[model samples]
Target: MRHTDLFYLLALQKVEGVGEINAKKLLSHFGTAEAIFAEKSHKLKKIDRIGSLTVERLKDKSVFEKAEAELRFIEKAHIRAIAFTDKDYPEKLRHCPDSPIVLFSNGNIDLTNRRIISIVGTREITAYGRDFCKDLIATLAPLDPVIVSGFAYGVDITAHLAAIENNLQTVAILAHGLNQIYPKMHKKYMSQVMENGGFMTEFWSSSNPIREQFLQRNRIVAGISEATIVIESAEKGGSLVTASMANDYNRDVFAVPGRISDKYSQGCNNLIKTQKANMLTSAADLVYMLNWDLQQPIKPVQKQLFITLEPDEQKVYDFLNSHGKELLDIIALECSVPVFRLSGILLNMELKGVIRPLPGKLFEVI
Candidate 1:
């Protein structure tokens, strides 16, 4: 966007009563923020939800000064200010109802045709959570997914670091502005993260990392990804808030199950018990559930000369070989194998080059 256009948009954001929804309404009606500011108050009041008070606030000249200052900060910091309408904006997040009108970012971040997933959980991460989180990233590394997180301690940092180690792009969505880093201790990782993926935020340069900001930050972590995975959490925490936001966005949510007695497992277990999230036992479960395998180029289906199959795999392969192509449920039913067990068996068969998975959960023998 042009500097004048961004200046007006930033000013519009500073309008007291013009929130994301209302701002969208105004932008849609007026065509541009500059046009909205140019229009008379009476004309603006004609739009739905544009109350007289909000229209009056549009006249506040002080907002323009703040917007000017923010623009200076953005220029100096070399941040990319992305509007919701931009093609480069997160595609998944653009569909969200309460997505930010503008996003500020810095780094080698790219979301085009990428498989993005958010990993969020307890700030006080445990050993089990750490191991599961690391292994999950390692297993999914082959697919080159973009890992999104809040960039906090524990699970958030764990996910980011794992993605870096795996050489996958990782995004850190912040609770505050780009001018400063939070937790102070995490400053050391800034350069590494920027090189790997980058930082993103909706907050202005003056905003600070505070309580409400974290809650607001949760939505970005959830909305920006194809799925949100909870590595571990207590009965209540910000990670759970992120999971809830992901659910509200109608995106997939996954939770790593742990022993019931573990304190951090309570939230994930509750999410599963309530049918809010899928039980994420391994990376295969995620791949199978999300149909991510279908997006990749399938290997040529030439049967390996001496590949061995487990009995269950043989049953699945025999069914597919005879049936041509069959739905996962049908194979499970005919072979008397549970769907959960059948998925792994089919994956192993695919790896052995004896079978291939089709779209819509269909399977065929090589």
Candidate 2:
């Protein structure tokens, strides 16, 4: 975006009662912020929902001074001001009605034709959650999906590290400005994160990581990705908020199921039970749900040749092997197993690579 246009856009944000929705409305009607300011008061007031009070605020010349200062700061800091109309702006987020008018980003961030997924969870991550996160990332590494997170502790940091370790681009959506890192301790990982992906935020350079800012940041985390995964959360937490936002955005959401009594698992279990999220047990679940195709050839599963299978798994495998290719129901009936139980058996067999699951629950021996 041109500096002069950005200056006016920044000034538009300073106007009281002008938020993302209203700002967008004003921009859409007037074409540019400059035009909005240049228009007569009566014409401006003619816009739907643009009250006389807001028009009066728009006439406040002090906003230009603040916009100039912010522009100078952005130039000095070398931040990229991604306008909502920019071609480089995240496509998924651009469709959101409440997306920020401008996003401040830094480092080697790229979203061109990338598969993006957000991982969010409780700050107090448990051992199970950590292992699941790492294993999930490692498994998904083959498909090379971009990971998005809040860059906070526990599940957020864990997801970032896993993505970094797998050489996947990981974007950290900040609650504060690019001028500072929150929690202070995460400063150590800044270099690695920037090298792999980068940081992004809608806040200005002067904003701080306050409570409301973090809550506001959740929307970006949810909207930026095609899907959001809740690794673990309490019955109530920010991760749940992100999950809810993802659902509201009409994006797919997946939750890792944990023991019913486990504290962190309560949120995920509730999401699944309430049909707010799908039960996510492995990377294959995400891959299948998102319909992501592997770019590289899948390495032949040699382990299946020597791998052992339990009785139920062996029974299902044998039935599928004899039947050549069969639907899940047929395999279940032939094996004398219920459909619910057979689903788990087939999933295990698929993971073991002894059997391959086809579309419509059809399975055949590999």
Candidate 1 lDDT score at position 291? 82
Would you estimate the TM-scores of all the predictions?
A: 0.86, 0.85
User: Compared with the true structure, what per-residue lDDT tens digits does model 1 show for residues 272-311?
Assistant: 9999999987666788889886776543456557887888
lDDT of 1 at 98: 89
Return the TM-score for candidate 2, rounded to 2 decimals.
0.85
For all candidates in order, the CA lDDT equals 0.89, 0.89
Cα lDDT over the full model 2:
0.89
Query: Model 2, stretches more than 4 Å misplaced?
Result: 294-355, 358-363
Instruction: For model 2, state the Cα shift of residue 234 in Å.
Output: 0.2
Per-residue lDDT for 23-94 in model 2, tens only?
Answer: 999899989999988889999988889999999999999999989988999999999998999999999999
